[model samples]
Target: MIDDKLKEKVQMLICGDLEAGEKAQVELLINESSELQSYYKSSKLSWDNLDNLAGIEPSKSFVTDFWKKADKEKNKGFRFFDFFKFNWKLAGSFAVFFVASAFFINNYFSDVNSGFTFSEDVEILNQLDNAITLNSDSSLEVYGPW
Candidate 1:
């Protein structure tokens, strides 16, 4: 039986999880010891043989049935709970879309002028283009000299 420390390191080496320096050190140690070399060889062979095993593929409906069964088991005796288990992400996205549509429609089709008008502000500024003064007796009223 391989010791625990060497067995663990051998597994790490076989799985390619060891650093370059640690891998070189382990290889050197294994080469110097016949018992470790034999253990590493067997471990490496077993690991490599795993890739040669055949893979089993499930039917296309296997995942659908699996989730259905899982959901059924989750709400086994409480049928009312299933009604509240719908996708929150889909519901939240729809709520956001409706809110955004309402906001856009309110702003775009409203008769009230509640938004900023850059042209109006620029006209007001142009009316006082050179009316600013730094005098103590002057009052800086809107769009007029005082």
Candidate 2:
């Protein structure tokens, strides 16, 4: 991997900003290392291509137009939640979903039996009450202090 120091040195070498000694050292390093040699070659090719490209001359109003657009955007305050603006359609759909789900659940359960007849339910309640009374009486006798 190319290190930050080596990358900076390579950039400086490409830009012709390195001193004579630094340039010589970078050149030697590039010559000795295949990775550095490839990196330098690609960098030099890209820089040469960029230099040879013809520059586009912008219209005189380009700067003014750009600033005007920037100012307009700046004047319109930015909010992170603006992208998540609530839609009434979405809310209505969610409401419809919940209502439909509730209706389905109610209809499903309404058809199911209570699993116990009325008389059976009354008998079970009575048995439960008797069991609770017996338990309380036994606990009192067992835990009573002398």
Candidate 3:
């Protein structure tokens, strides 16, 4: 468990913002605590070495170069639809085929159901011939004046 006073100093030390008294306190805490010592050593190593990284200096164009590379890599990222366009075309063609099939089936059933009407010409002709023959076959006569 880190003490409150030591915690404040540790934060200042890591941030490189420790005052003289804070630095003394941070040193004492680090000397007494293994955890604090480890944290301090790592912080010191990184902070102290950062200034001497191969004596390397950044150019004025570093920021522009960083942005250019970042933008290029971001644009190179795969878009969601680029790999699935062929599937989309296949699905579209399937939908069109399904719709046309439905239309043809509806027309075919409608023609069979509604366009096939009953034809009465043959039955009517047969009935008319029977009536003429029955009228002509009256064997008996009328009792009164013909």
Candidate 4:
């Protein structure tokens, strides 16, 4: 098998892309190596086949039909229902996500302030048989119904 460097040079030579000095060097090597010579012939044949290829022409009505299709699409207006027509799954997922987020927020993250009670001190005070009052001189006065 030919080495990679020599094979690349041979391909470049077949495509006429090699410089003058490189072309002469590769040609001399090809003449000496039988394997390189056969490789060069096959590469040249492939290149010639590619060079002979011609593009197929479009049908006579292709341009007119294309323009008619383009104009029809251009005149068509976008509708709100078009989003659901092609993307029902995406819309459904969004709806499910919104419902799940609402449930999680309401159930897992309920209002902590609503659970608090500021009337506990007053309830305890009412439970006492005697009333405890704070005097203006920072003294405690215990009094009852008298």
Q: Which portions of model 4 miss their true places by more than 4 Å?
A: 51-54, 78-146
Best by TM-score: 4
Worst 10 residues of 4 by lDDT: 132-141
What is candidate 1's lDDT per residue for 1-146, written digit by digit as tens? 66899889989988899999999998888999999989988888888898999899999999999999999888787775455469777767877999999999887666347555667768878766645443323554554774
Candidate numbers, best lDDT first, in rank order = 2, 4, 1, 3
Clashes of 2: 0
Residues 51-119, candidate 3, lDDT per residue (tens digit)?
876766899999999999999978888976565667988768877999999999998797678756235
Model 4 lDDT per residue over 1-146, tens place: 99999899999887799999999999999999999999999988887899788989999999999999999977887876676787989889978999999998886455444663458656766766244333422342244333
Clashes of each: 0, 0, 0, 0
State every prediction's TM-score relative to the real structure: 0.40, 0.36, 0.27, 0.51
Sort order, TM-score high to low: 4, 1, 2, 3
lDDT of each: 0.81, 0.87, 0.77, 0.81
Q: What are the runs in model 2 whose C-alpha is more than 4 Å off?
A: 51-53, 56-146
Per-residue lDDT, model 1, residue 103, is 97
Candidate 1, residue 40: lDDT: 87
**To one decimal, what is the Cα RMSD in angstroms of model 1 from the true structure?**
12.2
Top of the candidates by lDDT: 2
Q: Give candidate 4's error at residue 93 in angstroms.
A: 20
Ten-residue stretch with the least lDDT total in model 2: 79-88
For model 1, the run of ten residues with the poorest summed lDDT:
131-140
- Cα RMSDs, all models: 12.2, 12.8, 15.5, 9.8
